[model samples]
Target: MLINELSKKTGLSIHTIRYYENLGMIKGLADEKVKSNNYKHYNNNTIERLEIIIEAREVGFTLAEIKKILTSWFETTESKPETLELFHAKIKEIDDKMRYFKQTKRLLEKVCEKIQNNE
Candidate 1:
């Protein structure tokens, strides 16, 4: 399908899809038969790649990290253990950040209470 169709199917904006394509996370191919305009067509593989990108980003994976993981996933199966390890590390990082946020929230609440008491 065309880029517009792909965008609708993936629920991603055209600019975002083009951005990913520019970053080499996905690719679109121009049809050889159509010489009137340089329209690029996307296939199922592009959709799958975009889905992977979306899931990874939701879990806090940066684009560079996602690219590495996708490269490994597409190139060979030897990186399965490594990918699992990365995910575990990301989970730990999230846990640590959540604890930090909780502490900060409590501190802010205490400050607010102190200000109200002084008033």
Candidate 2:
């Protein structure tokens, strides 16, 4: 389908989709048979890729990291050591962030209790 349909299907804005395209994360191909406008078409694979991209972003993956993961997972035959290392590092970062979040949550809870006590 066209970009508009792809946008509707992916729930992403046209600008964001274009940005991804520009970033080399996804690709849209123009129909060669048509001689008029260079309208780019997307397929089911594009939808699947966009879904992965959305999920990865939600999990705090940067675009570069997401692109690397996508390329490694989709375009390559075997998993690379670098990709494994990157994922391991990301896991460590997420663990550290989780601890920080827990600490912040506890601090907020204590502050709330103090406010309730008027202390």
Candidate 3:
């Protein structure tokens, strides 16, 4: 399917799909004929990779990190364990950020309440 179809299927915007391609987060279409078109076509495999890439980004993986992971994944299927380890590390990082944000929110709420009460 074309980029538009892939975007619809992936629930990602067309610009974001292009951005991912530009950032090397995912590979472009393999066919030369398809490459001539302004928009690229994608297969099921590409779509699946895009899904994972998008989810990983949502969990705060930078484009550079995503590119590294994708490259390793494509090079060898054995990289699964390493990929999982990376994801676990990212999860821990996100959890730490969440904890900090919650604390900040609590502090802000206290300040707001104090200001409202003029105390």
Give candidates' CA RMSD values in order: 1.7, 1.8, 3.0
Give the Å shift of residue 34 in candidate 1: 3.0
Cα deviation at 61, candidate 3, in Å, is: 1.3
TM-scores, all models, native as reference: 0.87, 0.85, 0.72
The C-alpha local distance difference test score for the whole of candidate 3 amounts to 0.82
Tens digit of lDDT per residue, candidate 1, span 3-119?
Answer: 999999999999999999999989899989989998999999889999999999998999988988888888779888888888898899999999999999999999999999995
Quality of model 2 by C-alpha lDDT: 0.92
lDDT of 2 by residue, 1-119 (tens): 99999999999999999999999999999989999998999889999999999998998889999999889878995767778988899899999999999999999999999999999
**Candidate 1 total steric clashes:** 0
Q: Of the candidates numbered 2 and 3, which has the greater TM-score value? A: 2
Give residue 95's lDDT in candidate 1 (0 to 100). Answer: 99
- Please list the residue runs of candidate 1 whose C-alpha ends up more than 4 Å from where it truly belongs after superposition: none
The candidate that achieves the highest TM-score relative to the unseen native structure? 1
- Candidate 3's residue-wise lDDT over 1-119, tens digit each? 88888888999998988888887776666566655556556888879789878877787898777876887787678878888888899889989999999999999999999999999
